[model samples]
Target: DLSKNNKQMDKIQKSLEAFLENKRKEFPRFFFLSNDELLQILAAAQDIRKVEKHCSKIFCNIMKLKLGEDSNSNQIYAIISAEGESVAYQPPVKARSEEKIEATLTEIEQKMVETIAKKLSKFYSEYDFTNIDKSSWVFNDIGQVVSAFSQIIWTELC
Candidate 1:
């Protein structure tokens, strides 16, 4: 089975290499990074904390996005600041297409649902859901539970 897994991994590595090669063709700066570094960046793109260390490598400086809240409206805002390693970091000015942006947002939403579900796994497992009779609601997907939890969170926050 280990050999089989190794074969599969090899195939995956080849596919990933092809994809990254295409990406590098579009933006040649990627050539500066090794396969492992590029893979790390792609894998940790979902979490800023995880990807922060790699910022210096990709951007030539460490950058951080801090979250601040408005006291009056209670709205959250991001403040981008350069860290100690901030030198020669010319951040990209290019904008992705609207379709690509929407797709990335959807991916983020899905990842959030999965993360929340994992964090609440113990409560979800212990709680009985059979009693709640939903006349119109369809409880087919895990994201549905997250949507319901979002409503509860909104109610509590408001």
Candidate 2:
């Protein structure tokens, strides 16, 4: 059986599709962003969004470590909360030792770096940084590339 949330999502999708169809009739080239660029933009956006979403968790975990918690409960909660907003934290009956917590945090940091690397691989494959026209492009070129699709985002609305 389809969950209520799923059903609601389906209805929303159908409505959006209908609205888009009408818009397409009025504007054939409704989507201004290039398809390939759009994908890269979205991929980069997700990474930045993920980082921004979990920054507090990461910061809190580091603070807890500095505070000498001597347990992995807070760190685990940080990871879970960072990864999934819906996740609930339940402190372990047996607390992890300080050494264990440090080791685990080290591992988590490595994994986070790895996840970022994986997400960036697709973008790196597309852009040729070595061949960039550095003279013409300024410091924000990289950011510009990431948000190339949504140029308006980088532009002033007013």
Candidate 3:
């Protein structure tokens, strides 16, 4: 019975790690946030009054989010002070423009992959990077990129 409970605990720990990994992969910027900061953002995502509370956590100096209400739809609008950028609640009845072209996560990830590929290319001339999966962890953060190069360089010298 003790062994069974230990196995279950191990399984639960693995599941939680996998969940955190998926979340991290979805937003690499979360890498900069501490466990508490990331968890708080995930938990308080639905609140805006908390906006004023979280300003100092994410921004510099005394910048604040000025909250206003639209009289027509009674929707809330938040203008970021100093920067002047804003976020507003868009009504579902409104039509959105479909013509905007944006680079995909994969495309951006591919660019990141190319950076490390260039480094490895010097030694492994035949290693083709044409089809590297964007999901590769090479460029998720600066530490990962530096660690990758360090491992390769140290191995070569040894």
Tally clashes: model 3: 0
* Candidate that scores best on lDDT: 1
Report the poorest 10 consecutive residues by lDDT, candidate 2: 59-68
What is every candidate's alpha-carbon RMSD to the true fold?
Answer: 18.2, 19.3, 16.0
Scored by CA lDDT, what does every candidate get? 0.45, 0.38, 0.44
Write down the TM-score of every candidate: 0.35, 0.24, 0.36
Clashing pairs in 3: none
Clash total of candidate 2: 0
Candidate order by decreasing lDDT:
1, 3, 2
Clashes of each: 0, 0, 0
Per-residue CA lDDT of model 2 for 1-158, tens digit only, reads 56988999999978866755554344333244334433333344323322223234333322221111542222333233332322212332222343332233344455544543543454456545546543453343333234542342235233
| Per-residue lDDT of candidate 1, residues 33-71 (tens digit) | 788876775665444445445544543332542222322
TM-score of 3: 0.36
Better of 1 and 2 by lDDT: 1
Global lDDT for candidate 3?
Answer: 0.44
Q: In candidate 3, where is summed lDDT lowest over 10 consecutive residues? A: 93-102
